[model samples]
Target: MLIYSILFPILAIIAIIVFFFRFRSGKLSLSSFFIWSIIWIFVIIFSIFPDSSMVFARVFGITRGLDFIIITAVVLLFYLGVKLYYKLDKLEDDVNKIVKEVAISNEISLDDEEEK
Candidate 1:
């Protein structure tokens, strides 16, 4: 067996354990845990049986199994990155709005200060 076949599965198992712990600790939501588990499980499965990925390559018209896996990983990562970027932008806008409201509400007028 190829070394990566063994190494990848081992690494994937470690990742799954981390995800499980995070889920138990409430650091990861159920939906996120499920998604990450599915991804890692696939990694373990495919690494152990590299030929299984060949089926996907044939169906997708990819020239090689490794190519298919790389392409899929790239696409998934790009989608996740875009989602994160949008979420972060929304959070920044929300924080700015809240800060502006708080500042306005807490402001002390010059006339009020002079009267003190």
Candidate 2:
């Protein structure tokens, strides 16, 4: 209990600081920043009110609060993992496209120089 009281708030604060830096540096968009902010806020709330999970679990037909928390965390992590995977795939495709374009342009220039 004491550990939870200390760790969760600290984690939440660190997350908020990171979000602010990312947003300010333009690494994160406004909508993404807000979404992450809300997620961290939920973490803080649940951490402070741990027993609330019991109520939530009952509503969801879960047998135990801890089980509910674990399940929710797993689902959230899986969703985030999938989202990151897609983003990375898209970034890789974009980089490949740019590289191909540059290579083709350079080869054409070299050919033109040889002709001249």
Candidate 3:
């Protein structure tokens, strides 16, 4: 429990730093980072309580802290999976747009060469 309390916050801090850097570089969306940070904070807060496992077990019908952790982790992983899927979709759209622009430029260049 003590180790979890310490490690959870440290991990959250690291995640925040990474997200901030990515956002600043315009590689990440602010909304996604903000939502992820909020979830991290919740996990950190829950980790601080020794009885958190018990609470989670009672409230969620889980058997143990490890189980609760697994459930939460799985849920978070799924959420991130969905988020990444959307981001990939956006990237694909951006790539298609750039490709179309390049094709148009090439066509115009070909027309100019023909005229000359």
User: Which residue window of length 10 is worst by lDDT in model 3?
Assistant: 49-58
Each prediction's TM-score versus the true structure? 0.86, 0.85, 0.68
Query: Whole-model lDDT, candidate 3?
Result: 0.85
Off by over 4 Å in 3: 13-34
Sort by TM-score, best first: 1, 2, 3
Which pairs of residues clash in candidate 1, taking residues 3 or more apart in a chain or in different chains?
A: none
Instruction: Compare the candidates by TM-score and give the number of the best one.
Output: 1
Model 3 root mean square deviation, Cα atoms: 3.2
lDDT per residue (tens digit) for residues 43-81 in model 1: 988988888888989999998998999999999999999
lDDT rank order: 1, 2, 3
Per candidate, the number of residue pairs that clash is: 0, 0, 0
Q: What is the lDDT of residue 92 in candidate 3?
A: 100
